[model samples]
Target: MGLDTPRPRAAARHPARSSPPRRSLHGLSGPPPAHERTPLIRSCHMTHRSRRQRMHPTNTPSRRADSPIESLWPHRYSGVMISIVIADDHGIVREGLKRLLEVEPEFEVCGEAKNGREVLDAVERSRPDIVVLDITMPHLGGLETLERLRNEYGDTKVILLSVHNDPTFIQSAIGLRADGYVLKDGRAEEIVTAIREVMKGGSYFSPAVAKKIVEQARSPKSKSSDPFTLLSAREREVLRLIADGLSAKEVATELSISTKTVEAHRTSLMRKLDVRKATELVRYALRHGLIEP
Candidate 1:
């Protein structure tokens, strides 16, 4: 005899729809129960609500819904249209900033997110050169988002906007290597200046925040070494230009030096300041008043 064979398991059938073999229609059909009817009706209602999941490319951080069009508003700026990502949880704030930046020739708000969780996705999806985010966003706060950005989105620089200029927040942002900071209540001109400064690869602190930095300079906690003092005036100029957003090639072109020479200056600057990224070197330059604010 063949090895003892086991019968195959029957396929499961839905009790609601499966009819008993040769059963009368009366046994299989009925008016739906109240609970079952509720689900069917509810699902139909849900279908209406889920017709579309539109995204507003320039909607900013507080918009409850998106218009599904990217940059539905054309923007004019003084310089080249530098695409930007602005994040906050407030619609008015986002729209206001976008409108403000759009007035500058060189800036445009390409994407806006309402919270930190949306920052990365917005950055990646939008490919903005700069991400201007609120420091205290929900889901992920500004500091954490900055860290994530540095590690995960290396090329996109971050600018933190907040109402507070607390030393702790600034220090943490600097520690994480933020590219820029501005007060939410700061002047519109200051915000524009910040975008330009950061775009040129320099970090900016608003006037009040700058005062906090100056205070740090006078504090006993100051590091004993002064790196800026070590640089020659010429090297310092090159550093400023580099921080101002000119590539080594552009700086070299402007200064009439070999690209190699510009690279040497950058390398030396980094070494003298004990900083790693180009942005940090720029910050070091700005912090010392080597460059205009």
Candidate 2:
């Protein structure tokens, strides 16, 4: 159902709960225009000069000893380096990726983050061309983070790195139009290949992930439509807030909209999900992996 569903205006009888600062989907009120919703890519750089220096310790020719001189001179004239941000919860994992990608003179490790929020911040500041992100993180999960990145920062490509190979996770990433999906256990060369493929306007999935997609295509169970496709972006945002235990008034305040508008969105969500109660909505969200249990 559309978010245009209407509900009668009611008086606010309860108070909005105090909540920690979090990202808002539609600025705090009604659905913002498409152009206004996605942030403009301002030219900015991450202030991690010292940290990046620490990541690459040597200044000698031995680092490039194995590379042919012919390959190194082309990038200098082209003035193009594929910028990347590595987002992983583990410091060691980030370090490993940074070092691996740094070996390629054409690739630059521009920034790094430990969680979803930090990832957002890093991307905004660095304006990296690509983001290599872990699938599971605290504060926000990878799937949700991918949605935000696609919506708000449309220019950057995202590659999901995960330990899980479940069909649900694989399908979600594909639906979200992720540029690549690579398993953490895969060989280092796979990541390099994925980066190159995605940069060339192509997509890549790990061998195991590709096999899962093929198996899913052959299975009858894969034909079922995802219920999430039925809800509009605004309705989905309202559902997430409500599932997070926010009251209608609180959701209105958080979204910068009137209570009547929030109520209308809720009504539309209920109608679309075929649920009658707030608890049922929460259950639907949990079942669909919209919110944590």
Candidate 3:
């Protein structure tokens, strides 16, 4: 199925939602060309001065230090010296995220910037342990900043939290060596979970974001589809239907197969996909773009 894309039209920002797209230098509404996006990002940094946020210096070098924030985390993780900088174009979103981070003591919102330019200056001065960046900030979007940041400061870990769940976007970040990608719709607690996971040297992706990439990777266009490709043709058929929200009986009726056959196919599919339950299989199928909702 073709992916449903809601374009970033400034004019379409609903009554209670966001802003209209600014008059582009060219007087158009679409995003800037790919190459221009990078330079535009640098321009944002070049224009900013000082930055601010909820950050305070940490006493411990490793993450084992107990900060007030770490104790409050949903999961008890060693409060590492995880200095985080926030860069999003929306002030409301940035503040909300800061408040959410306060839920867990393991994270420190060291600096905040409303645009890409401010982010660059904050990075130079803050030297944070991690940077939580939004994909489309004014002056410089996330992708542009990410490319430059990775090229220059290889030490910093970047976690992108954006509305965009495009596999292309995730692959681009992964290609540039970004540490993680989380989605904006994720619960505040999951964001903290992602931060801690990345701090612990594990890569994290929001369930949705991860699914997109995994789905793309399993597409026929990819070569090493072995793990996911092992599904028998019937298994694949049943898997796709199940993920699309059909029950076993429903799937059986549709495919003209017995309920027992559907059950067996589901079992084989689960084992092959390395997923445990129906939900995980759904996630796997969603990742592979076999399902959409």
Candidate that would win on TM-score: 2
Stretches off by above 4 angstroms in model 1 are 1-79, 222-293
Local distance difference test, each candidate: 0.67, 0.76, 0.67
Question: Between 1 and 2, whose lDDT is larger?
Answer: 2
Model 1, 109: alpha-carbon shift in Å? 1.4
Q: Any residue pairs clashing in model 2, and if so which? A: 28-255, 28-256, 29-255, 29-256, 29-257
Ordering by TM-score:
2, 3, 1
Candidate 2: where are CA atoms >4 Å away?
1-79, 223-293
Cα-based RMSD of candidate 1: 20.8
Which portions of model 3 miss their true places by more than 4 Å?
1-80, 220-293
Where is the poorest 10-residue window by lDDT in model 3? Answer: 38-47
Clash pairs, candidate 1, are: 62-90, 62-91, 77-104, 77-105, 78-104, 78-105, 78-106, 79-105, 79-106, 200-245
The clash count for each model shown is 10, 5, 12
Full-model lDDT, candidate 1: 0.67
RMSD in Å for all candidates: 20.8, 28.3, 25.6
* lDDT, candidate 1, 50-125, per-residue tens: 3112111233233212332213423212123467888988899999888988776556677889976688888777
> What's model 2's lDDT at 165?
80
User: For every model shown, what is its TM-score relative to the native structure?
Assistant: 0.49, 0.56, 0.50
- Residue 30 lDDT in candidate 1: 57
User: Of the candidates numbered 1 and 2, which has the greater TM-score value?
Assistant: 2
